[model samples]
Target: MACYRVVLIPVDENWTPASPDDVPPQPPQPNERLLETEDFFSAVREAIQFNQQTWSERKGRWAVVCEVGCPGKTWPGLRICTPLRYKIASIWWPPGWEPNSPLDMPLCICRTHGTLQEDQLSYEQALATIQALNQQAMDRASTMWYVMLAVENEPVSRTISYDPAGLQTTVEIRRLHVAQPAGGGHGDCSHCPARSLDCSMVAPA
Candidate 1:
């Protein structure tokens, strides 16, 4: 298991825009940077340079470090520092619709900051946390929520043909919500509006 720390730096200049756009601004997208370690200040400086020189934008003023991947041992929860957007699958993905295998089903209920890991938090929690936080206070970065999760280390085996470096077996650490409510596709929502056409809790006829 590996613990990766990455800083999610914003690309917009004004932290608080005058007005909200018709569609809310999207969060930063995570990349292989989670696996790379340069340094804190160095990473931030690079982000600033990239924004200024590459994109011609004077952004990257704020950044928050997020721990990605899994730890060796079991942990109760993980804190997500970046601003995340809560989302659910549309009616297009009607209940019981498994586009892929169970392991590969698309996200139905999840909290995300466009990162590699899906930070699962109820919509109520996500809304309240973002509202309570003072968007202007960079010092309150630590005042984020710790999303409860269940971590498992599974062993996997694979066959390799190359003899020079034959390493095909490894242990994978999987993290998931301890007990995601069945409501999204299984039953009534624990906390949400009454089932409607657009409601995620609605089941297929």
Candidate 2:
């Protein structure tokens, strides 16, 4: 099974990162309506389930552990940021789980020591890179080049036919291309002398 760490925990504004010497947080009070608490399993679960909206809203900010060959998450890359599935009863995990351990809860289950930021920074970088490449192709050859973003020589992001900013969404996995004419099966790749394919994804600075 993959290891998980708690990334988003609903806490008070004044809450500070817990230290080893500090006492563990107490159960939610009768009036703290943020996360509606059931019989507590772990401190993290209490934060996740106590409120209906607190965790639901945070689902948008989910993160993933960066794979070795995989482009680090955050950029406007193709890999979809999916919400992890979890059952409340499963929160009562076996021994060895600590406060900072990867949470197995239903928001994000990180496999790495931690997770990349959920802000889709990688996608933004990828978009910017492709826009530059598109401009280069237009200027160099006066033709539109399909810019493909790659990581470890593999194209993990979408194959863009034109400008990246015109895209409706970034997590596109399939090759977004134009419909080929009869008897011409993606002939542009073989026929277009000005065509080029390149990766725009780069590690965060």
Top candidate on lDDT is 1
lDDT of 2 by residue, 37-155 (tens): 22112222333332224334644222221112234233222221112111111111212211211111111111222212223223235345434543454356422232222221123
The list of candidate 2 runs beyond 4 A from truth reads 1-121, 142-146, 150-205
> Which residues of candidate 1, in runs, are more than 4 Å off?
8-10, 15-60, 64-174, 177-205
- In order, the Cα lDDT scores of the candidates are 0.30, 0.26
lDDT value, candidate 2, whole model: 0.26
The alpha-carbon lDDT assigned to residue 73 of candidate 1 equals 21
State model 1's lDDT. 0.30
User: Candidates' TM-scores?
Assistant: 0.20, 0.20
Number of colliding residue pairs in each model = 0, 19
Clashes of 1: 0
